[model samples]
Target chain A: MSRREQAKEENRARIRASAERIIRTEGIDKLTMRRLAEDAGVSLRTPYNLFGSKTDVLIALLEGAGFDPGDALALRDEQLVMEQLFATLDHIEAFFDSDEKFYREVYGGIMSSAHPDVRSTNVERVVAMCQELMTHAAAKNELQIDTNTRELGRYLGVQLLAVLGMWGAEFLSNQESIRQVRRAWCGILLQHCSNASHRAVDAAYQSVALTGS
Target chain B: MSRREQAKEENRARIRASAERIIRTEGIDKLTMRRLAEDAGVSLRTPYNLFGSKTDVLIALLEGAGFDPGDALALRDEQLVMEQLFATLDHIEAFFDSDEKFYREVYGGIMSSAHPDVRSTNVERVVAMCQELMTHAAAKNELQIDTNTRELGRYLGVQLLAVLGMWGAEFLSNQESIRQVRRAWCGILLQHCSNASHRAVDAAYQSVALTGS
Candidate 1:
């Protein structure tokens, strides 16, 4: 990379890391622009120059964590349906590791928001990912059901989100919580497969193979 | 009721209603001793005298909203199975609606707690209720499966908890979210019923009827 670009990257990284640490210690509500800039050992204007505003910084932080800038929408189509399912679930756990409290704060805030951007953008991304997962799973005959796969997928994904929110909030953490969730998820999928009409499964698989779905 | 008992009851109701209003308007974290006193038209010392602490007041608020004192044990009994399951769930929902922000605060507090009183109490209550639900459901041959019914019951319960938390966090309006949850709960229950073997069902029904379970 060019010297100027490298310099800019270093500055942004410093800002994000410092911001993250501040959030870890003080919490999302306490993460002020001045505090972040001071924590990063830079002038207050430095953050404004780099991030524009607190919201931009938040988007940047979440983007860094694989929730923003279309990360949820970028699932690899090459993977098997089950692999995709587990991998995304893995992301839910890892996201908790990165910044647990921030996840809860953002989740609680965006979900409770009346703003159109907040509502539409967050819900659509989740619903889109669900549709993609369910459609692919159905095509592979891994998820069979008479019910709409899109809706089922959405429900499961949101369920994961909910659990993660609870975990972040600190409502769930038995030695067995994750194991329990996995079993429950497995049961849902297994039942869905069992419930699928044989003809429906056959048609879906056939259509998928021919259409590269 | 005796005069002193009646006065205590009035104070309790007054505290709960005032706390609910404050939490709804300004959010839960902002629920300071001073604000509560101002809003409730009582002395600042009154809260401490009446409930001992903010957490105690919250517990009372939840109790006032339908959390029975003996529910943790009552819901675990086989004889009261259906009443237990239904009442436990309805109380859970009532807590969500009694005051959205306070519910978030307390539920958040409960979930992330290292404190035994906070975490263990909730866990004990849930596990007891689930075990009771499963035992009854299994006895009726409603959930005959290869795995333990108690474990299955817990798994399903957590999934519902997870979903309800997100839904309560306001991804949807309260009414619609509750409706969706009830629908999903039925779907889950029906799937279990369908998968149970005939022998298991007959034995379960007999067990349930014999014990009036």
Candidate 2:
């Protein structure tokens, strides 16, 4: 990369790291652009120039974290669909667990923000991740999605967002949240699974008997 | 009631009506305690004393809209589970359609607010409505949910929020949002329905063939 590009990339990384630190220690409400600039030792306008707003910084933090759905989706026959799906979710759970308050703040910001650009970008990322999983499942004949996979993927994607929202809001216990999500996801898969995949789906559903409400 | 209590109640009602008018005509972002008080011709402290926050006013508006889940749940086999469920949703859709922008703002406000009380109360209300439907379904033997009905109710409730969130964000068309919700809901009911209800669920699913994604 050119020197300018390299410098810009380094600046972004520095901003993101500082933002993450602020969000983790002081909470999302405390991490304004000015605060971020100060923490990162950059000019006041640097945060605005680099990332447009607090939500963008949060989104960048998410992107920087190793939660790539494409990587997760690439596992074709390496594992069962259920296993891979849960693993993908587990990856997300780990992210949330790492900094529960920060994740909640970012999610709440994404959902509640009036900014169209922020909402669209975040929703697109979620839909893409879900589409990756659903598309992979459809291609492998593990799930019997008869309709448009894109629609179904978006459906699943938004559902994940809702579950996380509830979890973040403290309306659902961790086990209950996981259980409810798994049931809904498995319910959809079970409805569409071929006889070949039926046994595997049921086995997977029963494997983790999350007992609490 | 005492005269003082009666006057206080009347003042609250007037304030709410004025707030609703501002929300519908000017948009939610236009709403402020001072604006509401001025519109209602009350003192500035009245709005705050009456409802505490803008979100509380929005919640009151929702409650006043005749969208009571208790009433819906009280229907003991007055209609099939699917019919009752859709009717309840239709009631909500009607509210959304009545003042699309206002409802979106209220929903966005509730979701995004950092106040735990607001989030908990709002989520509990949604969950209660869903649970009412699921509980009623189980009572009438219209559905055979294998897991905890409360959990399923919470699942469906949260999905409804997600769908509304996307709709407000303009990520999904109105028809697509409705279709997606009904499809996922019916998909779940189809899995759990008895043979007697299977035909009903399938018919309901096909009754509204929303074509676009």
The candidate scoring highest on lDDT is 2
Model 2: colliding residue pairs = none
TM-score of each: 0.68, 0.85
Off by over 4 Å in 2: A74-83, A132-136, A143-146, A168-170, A173-175, A207-213, B1-6, B143-147, B168-170, B207-213
Give per-residue CA lDDT, model 1, range A30-92, as digits (tens).
777798889888889988998876656665777776664236435576765655565555555
Write model 2 residue lDDT over A1-213, tens digit each, in one string.
Answer: 999989888989999999878877887668788898999999999888888877777777777876555575456577766567776666766767786666666666555555678877766777787777767766777665463567667766766665665665566654566565666566566666666567777765664432244
Range of the 10 consecutive residues with the lowest summed lDDT in candidate 1 chain A: A204-213
The TM-score of the first chain in every model comes to: 0.63, 0.82
lDDT of each: 0.57, 0.70
True lDDT of residue B76, candidate 1: 56
| Model 1 alpha-carbon miss at residue B19, Å | 2.6
